[model samples]
Target: VGNDTEPYKTQKYYGQSAFPSSAQTLTVLYNDHFKPEITTSFETGFEIRMFKNRLTADATVYESVTKNQIIDIPMDFSTGYSGAVLNGGKVRNRGIELTLGGKIIDGDNFKWNATTNWSRNWNKVMELPEGIDGQQIIGTGGTASIIAKVGGTTSAIYGFGFVRSPEGQIVYDNAGLPAYPEEIQYIGDASPKWKAGLTNSFSIGNFTMNVTIDGQYGGIIYSQTHHKLSEQGKLNSNNMGRETGFIIGEGVVQNADGSYSPNTKQVKTADWYTRYYRRANIESNSFDASFGKLREISLQYNLPKRWLKNTGLQSLQFSIFGRDLATVSDFPIYDPETAALNGDTILPGIEMGQMPSPATYGFNLSLTL
Candidate 1:
């Protein structure tokens, strides 16, 4: 594969850096010392067929190591700059993919075929070239943020989390709301544990039918839209605790001596949700993205030869197809496959006011000469 690298980045200047007059002056935004990134990868795949070549299987395993990772490293403004683009990290990824296909039945007038595929990936940060702390900010869009750390997975969702007692009981603050740690905490991972798909096709006489179902399991996504709309009292979740006078959060409080006691704070109805449910910057906004979808379906039929004998048309076929017809997911907003930003981005699994995936259906006609 070809090398992937970003263009060289330079510090911003308030004025032109070059001299255009007798005197020239400018302010640099940050120090610019970035190097190109490099990735080394190796992959191997094999295929097998059995049962009189009616069943076939293929598998592949691959690993990749990326070095000299160019990232925008953060810095204190006291240094006269916000951050700098520098070559400062390493990441490794490994995965396996498997596919199986079978001709379940074959005859002069009837045929059926099936295919399935599955894949899984694991990633880790091998090193940080800048020698910075274990965790560093990599990307941010609205309340959602991504952080990279040594020995941690990539694209990890970083946000505020509720404090808990030693026995895993929620801790409430004096204000009766769930207390949050001062520092941002890693709350969720954006990578799925595995993905799979199945497709089947059948044909008899002049009619054919095909359908596919796919699914992704074991990942989380943050919905900035849900957070915002809930805060605005527009989401159904916002209705909770509103009709009631108060709602008590579940958990125990930790006293000064580190003793855990049952929480007796009666958080006001509005106060309870606004602090815990709203985007008060405390609640974990991440939700499971595991979902299954009816990806595609189609039906086709070939016209009988006698139907167009005088027209000199040897063959004609008509088909009706649909895409993204249905989906089942726990995610509250749009389809789990939707992304806030397209193309290559530092952070994934973030949805900020994303549109729903539209289902499409159409018909096609083909004529053979």
Candidate 2:
């Protein structure tokens, strides 16, 4: 079928227009002039097995291109409308995945098997509509915003950052406190560069055990909870220099002649923490998303054949399972996996007021006749 413009014209009856003319004064805010976006993708991979199927490996590489991306653009007051959307952007995404498995120990009485999988991804914006630099903020969650900028990573975390001089030395204001960037800058990449998971299984006669460990690396997450708590003087980092005389910042100051010298100024303990925690920048509030977790474990046993022979049941098994037993991460409070706003919104890495994932432990029983 041919492409159609104004695809939603027939759906306009559901909004303000549905009411009688006397019921309201203000009506629809803007016209819908957007079209459906298109995405093209390609994927290719290979798998190999050896040692009588005891060892196996596979890898995949994929690329996807999104064209005519639709985004809600802000409008000026003179237009008498809040916003208008157009489709005129492009982005490219590519990634690779790898999987490996092997039966390390094979025997009649005892057997052990292990498997691991890994993945990596990269993405960037290629184009945008004319007259637009292709910079758009999709959402503001917590202290950072999810932004898309041409030639930058997709849905990068954008927010204020500490001002740094050309020599990468921290810049300070007249108050002897750190200064913030004049505009929002790329604070961190929300997406992970690499991730991996490993699983191990053991079997001895009718008894079995399984364990899984998983990790994510090379990413950043903004923690709104930590920032707010620190501001309230509840965090340990904020309390460290409380009884001390003052806190000395670590950086060199740039002189008028472009020479750098160590900063000798000291800021009040409370004032320093407050300023940095409250208005410093996303980098201060950001934490590494890299973490490893004991993802899952289980133990199971089947009844002896002789014991079940007299019973009507053909087989019986019992098992105990646990998930998310422990995690090793520098990020405090809620899990980094928690998304303040999820579903359809591509911006990630900003967490605010979200609950932590609960650990689960349970028993399972099965019977067959």
- Screening candidate 1 with a backbone cut-off below 3 angstroms (N, C-alpha, C), the clashing residue pairs are none
TM-score of each: 0.86, 0.87
Put down candidate 2 lDDT per residue, 1-369, tens digits, no spaces. Answer: 113344333234333456576333322243355566778899999999999999999999999888877666776768665555567788898999999999999999999999999999889888876546557777887668887788887668988888787778787765767776688788888888799999999999999999999999978988878877886778766766677858777766667887767777798877777777764368789988888999999999999978987799889999999999999888887577757664556357888766878999999999999
Residue pairs clashing in model 2 are none
Give per-model CA RMSD. Answer: 3.8, 3.5
On a 0 to 100 scale, what is the lDDT of residue 161 in model 2? 81
CA shift of 369, model 1, Å: 4.5
lDDT measured at residue 339 in model 1 versus the true structure, 0 to 100: 65
lDDT of candidate 1?
0.79
Alpha carbon lDDT at 98, candidate 1: 99
lDDT of 1 by residue, 228-311 (tens): 676556777667667777877788777888898888888777667667755635245678989999999999999999998889
